[model samples]
Target: MGFRDIAMFNDSLLAKKAWRLLKNPKSLFNKVFKARFFPNYTIMEAKHTSGGSHTWNSILHGRDVLLRGCWRIGNGKAISIWQHHWLPRKHPPQVLSPMVDSLADAKVAILIEETSRQWNHEMIDGIFTPMEAKLVKAIQLSRYEAEDSLFWPFTNDGIYTSKSGYRFLKAEDQSEVEEEQRANLLRLNKTTISSHQIAATAKERLAEFALTIPRPQYPRVASTPFQTRWLPPSQGLVKINCDDATFKDQKKSGIGVAIRDENGMVLASMAKHLRQLYTALEIEAMAPSTALTFATQVGFHNGILESDSLVLTTALINNSTYLSTDGLLMEDIRFNASYFNQLLYSHVKREGNKVAHKLVRHALCILDFSVWMEDVLPPIRSAVLDDIVGFS
Candidate 1:
């Protein structure tokens, strides 16, 4: 059966007379109130106990009266005359006026007004708490009213009636105030000196030290030594390998590079951490520089410098501007690369550069200087080396 048919069948079990009664407005109202409010209100109780209780009994009674008035209106009855006249106006005045009078008599109202004035002086004078001023006010007002002094009962010396009084001239009080002021002055002096010292140190240490260094002049392509000679037949074609090294949290980083020839053998391998923190592009440049430096040092000037960082490879090939934003380390990479007479830098995918990647990972794991050499280098000429060899 459909949903409406099911609902009709469910309702059909109810007696006809009862179902007709449910249609009446009064019946609906009774049902709503009985289901919603009646159970909660019927079970609520007001009992006084010895434990700490709220002082405002009239507030509770006022709320109950308001709720009953609402119930009457909901049942189609007019609000009571007393509720209409007194309930709207009486309780606020009764509750608030007594509280105001009590605060005024206790001199708390004056104390509150004077607190802002005292706070301003305290901020400038380095004294913060209002306890002393509050005590003074209490003492003076108690004497005026001829009441028992609350603060005096806790102190051996009676309260000073005036600043010119002999009690104010006592040595102990003067000495105590002087000692507190002296301590505060010393603290302020130390803080000022410390701040000035930090500023001066920063001025001295953080200022940039720029040096003028001569840029290397590139030799004519024909005059380059690597261009003048061909690779020996015994020396296989050049292959470039590139990879990155990672430290703990991958925060400290280094790049590893190796140059090999066609026979799957290593010609030269070098690894060095970028002395300063570097972005991926800088790391990529460092990898090529490492390979090129190794190649030049070992007299293999004609070699490919491969890198996993495409951006760095492109920048090097195009001889684009190198940014000094990462500080001198980026410039250092460029300076180092200028020494390579016949360098071919290429960007290779990480998968294609697995050998150098493994070398970097190995260097990081070893935590010491390492070198590997093979007499028979790889045979591929001008080909990038991508073979990853397991560490033995």
Candidate 2:
């Protein structure tokens, strides 16, 4: 993208105007443009007239540059699930499945739960293949109501900058050059480039890059790190420790919860092997939810819900806002905890959560969710003893 040629540079600048129109339809300039050129449709849908003005022609050129843009899905009301570029993970970035006649012209909102702003999992599974369903479920909806917006993904802020637009042009140009050279020059026994070199060369724009800075001064102070050890709850309360792990190779996730009395004796524990995978933060939030239910089922109305996840512990304790699918998960966690007569969220380091960690690891050997009552499982015997010994 360095030193964009005159033609592409102008196109990049024009693309900025297009972006502004899409970002701020309420702006006077955008409103005027829309009324004149595309009254019934969006700028993207605007057609070329028999004799359009130069300004309109330039905007269309910029709109061509915007073909690479995608929608950062929110309410999904305006986005077509089958037609729009919404699925971030897929190649071509749209639903590959043919539109069902029964649900023709359906908006992306159809796949979402209107009340909760969450994916309709059963509907997703019904509409898509297993792989597609996984991708759809993985997309976290905004916690609060948010409208769909088009954005360029190449830039950090998701706003289309002239620089990013220029980079797209430069990359496209480089690819065409390489293709022509390989087809014509390489076959004639001319100087040839390796496939690896071709890509590196095409993408290489920076000749020299470095940071000019001074090294930091050394600190003489020394400190001791906190050692992690599980703490017992007060009398008449059980403390439940929660942890979770994701297995990418196996395409699954697991959660472990251990409920112990003030004496550090395990009252009940659970290891669940989920059939589906979730993001780390989502799983972390879910772990506490599972723990709450496990303790409640055992008739423990008062307990300390503990975990190594500081994000969740702080969030639950503060009842703060978190922005997406994990936010929804936190809601469920607190909802489950509502069943407890007395509840608390506490955080500890990994060493203190060894029992829960080991129990979740044991989940790999199992097929589905499992729970233990009135006994310590063999896989986590050592971890349970460690906590008990620490308690004493």
Candidate 3:
């Protein structure tokens, strides 16, 4: 079996065990509690209670790892602003100093305007530090007025998984590497950018930097409407349609990419959430970058890439120019696009790309990035089916 099959099989086995040990009330150990198992709240809250059976002790032992990647979504009533990890940005939203006594015990709801059901900007501005205030302002209010809820940051379905947990822990190593790279880049910048050069022609240098970057071998083909319908890839090829959804208020966005066979049957898909970004177009540009990365990793050679972003489409077709920071990103995109032995880029209208759009929206609410092969996620299944039906 392939990697995808192995991953699915392992996940299936884990899901089955999780259901039995955690959700099945009829299980002997669950019967001891006389209640359903709650890994996050109930069991975790009772951590100090004198332990019971081996199973319960084992579950408690694993809680620490699980809790590391989980965060609370505050609805105001059920979670305290200061006590809980309600803000999704960090493990616990960083506060350099403790809050004043007046607001020490305040509920997250206090920051919500009762009538508007949104953040009370005045209250937030008056109380929080600038950084904290920005984070608070970016938070999306609870729409259903539901109590605080636990979110698993490692899974697309908001369900916990060992793979996600490992990924969460692995990020620390990646961060360290990134930090070192950033420091080196800063040192280079300081050494290379002379005072005369900085004053002489900043635009000229910027343009030079943009053009100096090497690009892929993909021909500079202007993006044209290939097939407006949900057409599949040609035989022996895969079509990857990618889209990005931005949640400006939440300071987050998601990338949705779907890969399909010539029959229009989905082979794999991804919905990945990222921290809030500067521009939607930047994120849009990322769709192709991500798609190409996944394609090359999976050993796909011939592919056609589709996106709804005209800006990204144009950038890829035309020669690089120092228009903005996006020019740098476009250079990277072009370099990656060359990985496929035969790759083509196309632009499609939003209507023809609903499946990818839906996938991106679904990604926004998820805690971690998700990838599916063979089995499509429930949210995007209908969208996938709709595309297939259109071919009929």
Which rank order by lDDT, best down to worst?
Answer: 2, 3, 1
Candidate 3 lands at a TM-score of: 0.43
State the displacement of the C-alpha of residue 89, model 2, in Å, after optimal TM-score superposition. 3.9
Per-residue lDDT for 1-392 in model 3, tens only?
Answer: 66754544444444334334543557776565545444444443545345466655555555545445434444566556665554545535434435878888787778887777678889888888887887777665433354454445455334555666545544544566666776787878843333335556788878889898986797677785645667777899988889887787887788988888887788888888887664665576677888888778767879888888876776566643422323335555676777778888778888778878888888977798888886468867887788888886
Error of 3 at 281 (Å): 13
Candidate 2 to truth, TM: 0.58
What RMSD does model 1 have? 34.4
Candidate 2 clashes: the total is 0
lDDT, residue 83, model 3: 59
| Alpha-carbon TM-score of each model against the true structure | 0.34, 0.58, 0.43
Q: Per-residue alpha-carbon lDDT of model 1 for 118-140, expressed as tens digits?
A: 21233212221254333222211
Which numbered prediction scores highest in TM-score against the true structure?
A: 2
lDDT at 112, model 2: 91
Whole-model alpha-carbon lDDT for candidate 2:
0.81
Flag the better candidate by lDDT, 2 or 3. 2
When 1 and 2 are scored with lDDT, the better candidate is 2
